[model samples]
Target: MSSQSSKQMALVAFMQAGSTSVYAGSWRHPAADLRFLEAGYYADLGRLLELGCFDLMFFDDRLAMPGIYGDSVAEAVRTGARPIKLDLSSVLGVLAGATSRIGLGATYSTTYYAPFHVARTFGTLDHLSRGRAAWNVVTSVNDSEAQNFGADIHLGPEERYDRADDFLQAVTGLWDSWEDDAFILDREGGVFADPSKVHELRYSGTHFNVRGPLTVPRTPQGRPVVMQAGSSGRGRDFAARWAELIFTGDPGLEVARAHYADQKKRIAELGRDPQSVKMCPMAYVVVGESEAQAQEREGVFLNDLVDPMASLTLLSELMNYDFSAHGLDDVVTDELIASTTGIRGLVQNLRSHIGGTVRIRDLAGHRATLLQGPRFVGTPKQVADQMEEWFTSDACDGFTLAATHFPGAFDDVVRMVVPELQRRGLFRKEYTGNTLRDHLGLTRPEPSKPSERGDDV
Candidate 1:
C-alpha cells in the first residue's frame, strides 16, 4: 500500500451520455454540446481527460428517465432534465477506441441484468481496452427502472442489497473460472487451450444460480476494477467487501472528512487494508482567471440558468417521492421522514443540513441549482488549494469532478487547475501505468480456487 505522504491524488471525470452531465440545466448552456448521440462527442472528451492524466473517466447512468415526479414525464421532457440518455456500455467502446491510457468506466445495475451478462460484457471490455475498464455497480433505485424490468416496484434496500451480494459472488466466481495461464495456442500440436486449466463455476445462491465458466478469457488486468457509489449503511458495507474505489457526496468539508474516516474504519474492520480502498467525494468546480469571475459564473448558473421546477423534479425522482403537491414553504415533518419509502440517508442528511426541518423550496434549490456536494468555485490556485487541503487532511483520496457545463467545465479543470495541481506536486503530470488497477496502485486479485469460491457468498 502507498503511504499518504508519498501518494499522488487520483482524479476521475464524471460524465454521462445525455443532454447534460449532472447539472440539470446544462443542456441549455450556450457552450454545451447537445449532440450526445454522436460517438465523436464522447471520443473528444475521453482524449481530453487522458491528456489531463486522470485515473479514469466514469459515466453515470440510469435505466429510465425522471418520471417519478407527479407520475408524469412532462416536466422532465419539457426541461430536458435527464430525458435523453444513451447506453453506457456502447459509449465505453467509443471511448476505448479514442483514448489509450485513461480508464473507461460505466454503470450497470445488478438488479436489472443477469450476473453472466454483466461479467461477460465487462470482461470483453477489459480486453478491448487493454485492461483500462471499470464497473460501477449499482442497485436500481427508482420505480420506473423497476417497471422497465417488469417489476411493479423497486425492491426495498435490505432485499436489494441481499440480492446484490449474491449477484457479485456469482459474477466474480465466473470471472475466476479460467486461470491466467488457461490459454495455450499450440497450433502445430493441434491444441487450442489447456482444458485442465479452465474450471467450471457451479455457483448456486439465493438470488442467482450460474453454471460453468464465462466464455471471456482472463483480461489484461485479470479482471476489471470494481467501483461502488453506495452511501447508505448497507451500501457502505457492500462497498467494504467488494469495492476497490468508492464514490460519495457530502455538503461540507467536515462532513466529508467524517464520512471518509468512517468508511476507512469499516474497511479496516473487514480485515482489509484501508489504503487498498480509495474513497472519493464528488466535487463541483468552476474555475476562472480570477475568483470574482468564477463567482460570477456560479451566480449565472444558479440564478439565470437553473430552473426550479426541473430541479424539484430531479429531486423527486432521486428520493422516490413526489414533491409537486407540497407548498414551497412547507416544512418536512417527522411523519414524512418515517413514512417515506425513499432514500432515508438522503432525507436525514437534508434534514441535518437545514436544522431538523427543511422547506420544499430550499431543498429544491439545494439539489438542483446549487452544488449538492463539496464545491470549489474560485481561481485555479484557490481550487487547487482546497483540493490539496481535503487530500492532505484525509477527507478523501481524491475527487470525482462533476461538470457544471459540458466540455467547458472540464476544460477549466484540465487546462487551468490540473497544471496548478501538478506544479504543487499533488497530481500526476503523465501516465505511470496502462491498466486501471496499475493506475490506481491496486494489485490484480488472484483467481479463487474452486474450494475457496463459495465462501464469498
Candidate 2:
C-alpha cells in the first residue's frame, strides 16, 4: 500500500538456488526448475527481484540438511531430498554482480563463528556490494547443524541465544573499531591512521571474549543491516535490542496484529523508537491473471509436490519436534504441548496465529491450508490489495516473497503486480538510497555513547 507520501511497502525475495533442486519436494514440481550449483540461477533470480523493485533478497541458510525426521537423512535426501547443503555467500557475490540496487542478505550462525570473523566477512561483503548488504543473525537451531560444525551436540536454546547476544555486540563493536575520521593522510608526518581515533572493543562476556579491534573497517552503512527471524518472547526481546528488521511467520492476520502489537510495545518499553524496529512477516505469493488461474496454479503446485512426506518432515524439523507420530486429526491444546527447550515459545506463537481447530499432524505432508509457509495467493491486484491492507493496518512493516515456482512466477509479479503498486504510488519508481539501510529507512547507528558503555572494575 502507498502512504500519503507515496512510499509503497517494501519487498524482500527469499531464495536459495538449490531451494528448487531438493527440500520439501521442490524438485518434483514440473515447474520447480532445479539447477546444479550455478551462478546463473542466482543471476536470473536477482534480475527478477530487481525488476520487481524489491528492496532486497535474502538467502536463508542452515548449516546442514534435515536430519530430525524419523531420525534419518534418507527421506530428506531421497526426496532428492532438501537443503542437501550449499555455500550461499559465494553465490551471493554472483547475484550482487547480476543486479544493482536490490540488497543482498545471507544467514550466518553466530554460535559457531567468532564475532570478529563475522565483522570481517560481512564488512567485506558490504564493500563488495557497494553498500548493499544485510546480515540475518541466527543461532543455529537443529542438531544437523551442530554435527556439521564438529560438535556432537547442539547447545541448549537459552545458552545459544546468550552467546548470540554477546556475539552481535562484539561484531558491531568491531565494525566501529575505526572511527569515521580514523584514516588521515598526514603527508608531512608520513602517518596514515590517527591512533587516537581507533579504539578496542574489549568485549568480554559470559559466552565469548572478542579482543579489541578487527582488520576491516566499517562499510557504507557504517555496518551491514541486522535482520532476524524469531517470534518467540525471548526472540522478540532480542530483536528489540539489536535488530533493525525482524522477520516472522504469522499464519493469520490476527497473529500478525498480535505480534505487531507485542513488538511495538516491547520496542517502546525498551525506549527505542517504534519505527526503528520493523516487524516484517513472511509471505509467499502465487499470482495469476485471475483468481481462478491462481487457484489452479496452486493445485498444480500441490500435485507437483515431489515428495509428500518430505514436506511434513521439513515442517517437523522447523518445529524441532516429531510431527509424524500423530495423524492429521491429532490435536494439540494450549496445555498439551511442552518442551525442555525454549521452543515452546515458537509453538505458542504458531498456535495463536494459526487459529481455529488445528490437527497437530497436519503440519506434515504436502499441501496444507496454510501451506508450507505463510502465504498469499490470488491475482496480482488481489494480492496487492492484501499487501496494502497489511502494510497500512500495521500488520507488517513489509513482506518476504518466496517463489512458489521460480523465474516465471517471480516474473509475473514484477511485470504484472509491480506496475499496479506503482500506479497506487505505494512503491518507489526509482532507488531512494544507495545502501540497504537507506532503502529500509534506517538511520545509521553510531557507536555506543560513553555512558551506554560499562566501565571496567
Candidate 3:
C-alpha cells in the first residue's frame, strides 16, 4: 500500500437519482423505491457519496426509453420500465444543498438543449456547488426522444456528433464570456461593472450561430469539469478535446485498455496534456465479507423485483427494435442487434460470452443488459484486488459506482468496499482537495485566446 506500488485513484457514485434498478425493473425490490423525484432521496445520496471518501456523485440521465420492445413507447410507460426520468439541474441543486463538498455531475444532451440554456444551468450549478460540478455531455440517439423533441426521426450518428461539436463550442464559448473579475463591487462611484473585461463569443458553426456574453460570471472551477461518456470513434474525438473526465460503459479490460491508450494518445495529439483527461468506467460493484456472500446478496437483490420479460421489452425499445421476438436466451449478433433492439455497443461486447457460457437470457437476466455499463461482483477484498489490477494495467483511470438500488445499495458500498480500498491505499480516506477539479487532478483551463479577425489588427 505504498505510493510507489502504483498510482491510486478517485471514485464517483453513479446515481440515476432514485432506484436505478440497473437490471431492468427492480422498482419492485423490497428495498428499492421510486421516490427520487420526491427530493429527499437524492439529498441523502449526496451525503452518502461524500461520507464514502468518494470524490463525487454523478447522476446519469437519458432522454428516452430503450428500443428493443418495438417502435411504440407504450411498453416502457405501461410496464413502469424506467417509467420516470427527472430533470438533472433540479435534482443536482437539491443534492448540492445536502452535501458540502462531494462533486455533483449530471448529463445534459447537446443534441437537444440550446447552448445558452446549457451554459446558464451548469454555470449556476458550479457556483452553487462552489466549483464541485461536472457536466456529462451526450448526444440524443433515440427516436422516442427525438419525437419528444418534435423531430420526425433521430439525427444520423455522424450528424449528431457534428451537431454536438458545434453545440459544445457554443456552450463553452459562452462559459468563457466573463473573466473572473468582470463584476466589481465598487459602490462608491455608483459603478458596479467593468464593461471592457467582458467579451462576447460570436460563434457561427455548422449547425449553430450564437452570439454570447454569458449572464453568469466565471464558475468555481473556472468552468465546471467538462465530462464526456461516449466511446465510439466520434465520441473519442469529442472527449479528447473537451472532457476532463471520460465515463465509459466498456465491458472488458482489453477493450477498455485500448480505449484508454487511444484516448490519451489522442489528447496528446490534440496538444493537450494526457493526464488532464481521466478515463473512468461505470461498474456495479457488489461487495460482501466473502465472495459467496456477495453473490448471494446479488442474487437476492436481483430476485426482489426482476422480471426478465419486462427487461427484454425495455431493452428492445432502447435499441429500437422488437428483441422480444427473439428468445430471451438466444445468442445475438451485430446483425441481430441495434439501438432499437439491444444497445449495439453492449451486444457487441457481450458477443464473446454468448456461445456456450453466456446465454441470451443471462444477458436478459432482468431483460439482460447491465444497465448502460458492466458489473463486478465479489467480496470487498476481491473487489479491491480487481480494482488494483484494472488501475495498474491501465484499464481505466478509476471507477464510477452504480447501485442496483438507491440509498441502501450505495450505503453498502461506502461501508464495506470503501474502507477496504482505503486500507489498500487505493483510495484516499479524507478529502485531499477542496474543489472537485482539484480532487480529480485537473488544471483550470486558460481563458480563450482573443480573436484575430478581418477587423482585428
Q: Rank the candidates by lDDT, best first.
A: 1, 3, 2
Cα lDDT tens digits, model 3, 1-457, are 2333546687888777544555555565567766766888788778888898788788777777654365655666665667567888899889888988898899898878999999899999999888898888878656777778898777776788889988988888787777777778788987677876677778888988877778888888888988887666677888898889988776677767877899899999999999878888887787777899889877775665566656766555545567656775666554565334223555544554334555457656624435345567798777777777787888888888777767677888889888888887788889878889888888888767546111111
| Top-TM-score candidate index | 1
Please give each candidate's TM-score.
0.96, 0.91, 0.91
Task: After superposing candidate 2 on the true structure, give the runs of residues whose Cα lies further than 4 Å from its correct spot.
Answer: 1-7, 21-23, 186-189, 324-329, 333-336, 340-346, 353-357, 365-374, 449-457
Question: lDDT (0-100) at residue 192 of candidate 3?
Answer: 77
Per-residue lDDT of 131-244 in model 2, one digit per residue for the tens?
888999988777767787898767877788888888887888778777777788989999988766676667788877776666876688888999988667778888888888
Model 1 has an lDDT value of 0.85
Q: Which segments of model 3 are wrong by more than 4 Å?
A: 1-6, 65-68, 302-304, 324-331, 337-343, 352-374, 452-457
